[model samples]
Target: MLHHRPAHTPVRPTPRRARTALVLAVAAAVAGLAACQAASSPPATTSVTPAKAPADRPDRGARDGEAAGHVPDGATVFDDALPALAHLDPALLAALQAAASDAERDGVTFFVNSAWRSAAYQDQLLREAVAQYGSAAEAARWVASADTSSHVTGDAVDLQQTGGSQWVADHGAAYGLCLVYANEPWHVELRPDAVDEGCPEPYADPSQDPRLQE
Candidate 1:
């Protein structure tokens, strides 16, 4: 599913090219087993009390029926360009919020589909993936160890919403956000240099990211 684009692959807007890219990206997201809610896993242990969010965050509470497992509904919120995620990296969250605000002017909204998962949740997810896929080796391609996951450190976010991913794919570099994987278009991370120097080339998947090698 991850079409291996030669390094420095250029993005173009032709309809045929768009369709090809869409097909490949969708396949990659599915095969790579990324995307938060789209790739469901077992429930996490629930916590009655959530850590306090920043004062500047929107004052919203848990909504019924979000797909982020047993985590607090308070973990997710809908704000200008923010997604419903818990424990997002403060800097990344702020940058995303600002980018969302700008995107709204263009009629695009970004929503957080996943963020900051506990190690227990991630382990459970890996276990589930292994069971569903029938092997740890296969599952490893889809899930990472708890400690290595950016989601655990609140440094990564998976998005949802109609055009959010596409918009970010096109304009996010200006805000220091860059798509981290060629297969998982929904996954993004802060790339400070992207704000001025442009986004760097993407890795094909988690396996290729140096941070996950351990």
Candidate 2:
């Protein structure tokens, strides 16, 4: 008798489960897009760079001289205090040795009286000269202009030949040394070949602080 009842199977939507799954999938997709958008945004980065400082010079004389109105650069500070033959370039030293030997052979003994002077010492000399002379004008007569002065630059040397000034004047050519200034009898400079092309020529007058070239 109960079998006469129509067969009833529960009808539900598998499509409802699909609809719920689709909504969850779309939500996940939106979340994934938000994550990607966050990741793609540019981040700020800080970059640090260091600054460079001016070069330092160890030569006290050079530093003080510059402050006190002298013109020698820091690059030349180390060079200003080297001993003769000791400070000279090796090849130049060899040439000097050969020339000295030649001078000896010719019965002239070439001696180094002085070479290499610090700018401070040079300043001291100038000051002392001024004190003694009583004015810059008078001091200028006794002392040399700092720029053209060989004593200030290591390149200039004081030489005393065994024979005499005349002997050196006659024979110094072989050594490639010359007397550049009439006032300095004991002074001799390297020949043109040995001389640095960078060496400043008769420098500017001290009364006017014109730019000097190397």
The top-ranked prediction according to lDDT is 1
Q: What is the lDDT of residue 150 in candidate 1?
A: 89
lDDT, residue 197, candidate 2:
34
**CA-lDDT, candidates in order:** 0.74, 0.55
* Lowest lDDT 10-residue stretch of candidate 1: 73-82
lDDT of 2 by residue, 116-146 (tens): 4556666677789899979977676545555
TM-score of each: 0.61, 0.45
- Number of clashes in every candidate structure? 1, 0
- Candidate 1 collision pairs: 83-112
What TM-score would you give candidate 1 relative to the actual structure? 0.61
- Model 1, 58-147: lDDT tens digits are 534442222332343222224422223536777888888888888889998776667767777778888998999899777766777797
> Which regions in candidate 1 have their CA more than 4 angstroms from the true location?
1-86
